[model samples]
Target: MLGGAGVLLGVAAAPAQAAEVSYATECIPPAAAGLDPVQGTTKVEVTAPATAKVGDEVEVVWKFVQAASKNPDLIDLPANSVQPSGTLKAAGAQSGDIAMQGPRENPAIAKGGAMVLSDMKGKLKLTTPGEVTLTPDAYAINVMSTDTKCSPKETVKSAATINVTAGDGGSPPASPDPTEGTSPPPTSGEPSPSESESGSAGGGGGSDTGGSGGGGGQTDFTGKEVAIPYACKTPIGDKNATSPVQINAKKDGGSYDLTVQFKGSVMDSPADIPADSVKPSMEVVLGGADKGKVHVEGPTNSEAIKSGDPMEIPDLTGTYKPGADGKSTLSPGVLTVKALGTTTTCTPTKSAVSLTLDTAAQEGGAAGGSAGGAGVSGSGAGGSGGGLADTGADDGGMLKALGLVAGTAVLLGGAVFTFMPRRHASRKAP
Candidate 1:
């Protein structure tokens, strides 16, 4: 599934040199699972062109060996359900991080069986004519819906280096065809950048519900992975977080079916979070040929979380329909999470487009798609209904009760505290 998600940049002209590097890595399963961290060695072989012209886009591949640890869960995992995502930290001539993702090609593994990760590739565009060093950074292996974040326990050696030279003002030479070694593109309607950017623009500005825009082509991004950054208000303070969102869209009769999945994230809580106290909602913003927002809400957690333990938010799902025609870009907007009596709102700090699709205009006043259905609520433009599900409890009363309980516990000296902080050290998920 991941193999088809690769972007087709131009190929290089010459054969690239690959370097093999192995290092020790430590991984921690999702905090909600309450599993101990494990240490293992990771071996990766990196391939990149030894030399490239400035401003040329070069492909870099990181092939991995068998994982250090096996499947830790009890159930057997099916093939191609595990996806790997990581960062290639670049230094020297180049100064930014390159996001690398691999196809979900893992073989079926029984519980506690050895795990294998797929090779990851990223495209790096050479800007300055100098040498650049690339080293593997922290990565995450998402099995099913759970994630195990891994990082090198020590300083990692460089995986590969590239020397860049000034290029002539002419067109770049073509390298080997990507199809020679990579998997073929999927037959599904995964739109290319060119196709997604095409189409005439027409749509309304602000409405919580209803269709806006003119008719155009359709773009299906069922399993695509999108990373969005959020600034969230936590019980402790304001903290920044990133969520890996998976989007699915299909054209139904007169309306489009859209499903947004939040892969889950590790959060901190200053107080105990009761079961079913937290609900999350997402606002998907539309741009390009159409303009508006679609709101999707998720369910609450089933288990109680003690204070100081990592708070894991369950995945959210919702559907929306588009009425307008033409290409519209969907980007993550505001994320609101309601826990206990307190509400934590997270807003996108940057403009990150998740997917773009063309929709056909609905004729005969077909009631445009509404966000409310399929275990989640959806609202179109100007909808006042909050994206989050109502707990039906009084927020002020709940907060006041919690405060009294905390005060009584302090007076009775019956308070208990447990804290197990996350241990990636200086490494952060890229």
Candidate 2:
């Protein structure tokens, strides 16, 4: 989570009495109520749109949300469009207003049930645009979401366009969540007990010891001695707009019941989950132009509890992109969930229970089991059909724009370009 200090850092670095700059996005809609969120799409627009200046960036974060009332009418109305096939196209006056150079895209996922929802979030890097000078400009900055029977609205919260004083290296903060200041309600299930970190810290401490992610912990006879950090990641090319978070639970001195817990984000709406390609996990499951394809799985424990011991769950693994320094950099664009673990539901008989992974036949021989590998292939040590690869997320050439071509003599002859909005912005709300 980006903290208030980060804003302070930006403001402190800003020149005293800096340029007058502000920002807005067409992320939300006017009438998103009474929707079940089957599918939806999201696009962006800017006001007085122009090429954004450097130091200022437009951030976007997209996720899935479920409506309180999952009416057949609402659910059938495109239960949340999330496919990462969106675009921030150029308009006559729109192109020049916001800067577009090195526009780092960040996409994240959060779990929103019928009572949960996802918000449209993206950050436009207010940088230098070609053939454009530094000055305040007006662009339409329109965000569009459409599909068959899908909600035709775009601006979720309105005030879509904003004015930012460019060239001063200043960017605007994200639209705040009205419920942010309020305390979040607790969940029903018993959470795994907190583990003492060799060097640990967390919560609203302004800082916490960054521990390893997913399922790696010690489980003794002590109830559930394992404490896994709820960490999340975004896809590559993301400019760090938002992140995916997960929580795992384990019982010590018990039969192998590895229950990995994960948390999804609450969005301003629920209709954008399927169309916009937003998910609760950092791992990408569907196929894409540049991201290729991913097989995902859920955390599981094959055996029932027997004695007191912490059971181990498959660790969530993917490619870790490093910064320019050659070391691993923790940002949105550099992260990707290569493979997801599959969850197998086996019946329980008396004192015995079995588990297996529900494998994908198309991907090849996979069995039913919970937990995943940390490998790009998602097979784990055993291999196939889930998230968590041995190595980090791979550059599978999955990033590319879609296009249509002519037939006949057009075989590698003339190339036609087709464009669509694909990635969700990862910039966090300031």
Per-candidate TM equals 0.39, 0.20
Model 1 C-alpha lDDT per residue in residues 1-430, reported as the tens digit of each score: 4554432222343568888888878776544333356667778888988877776777889888645454432333445546677778777866677778887666755544666678888887776667878899887765433456778888999988898776666543354221222222212111111111111111212222122222355433443344454555433234444445544555556555556654333334333444665566777776655556676666665666554456543444455455466666666677776643445566766545545665544443212334322335532121111122222222211211121112111111100011112242233221
Best by lDDT: 1
Runs of candidate 1 with Cα error greater than 4 angstroms are 1-12, 169-430
lDDT of 2 by residue, 175-204 (tens): 422222222221111110111011111121
lDDT of each: 0.51, 0.22
Evaluate model 1: give its lDDT.
Answer: 0.51
- Models, CA RMSD each: 21.2, 23.2
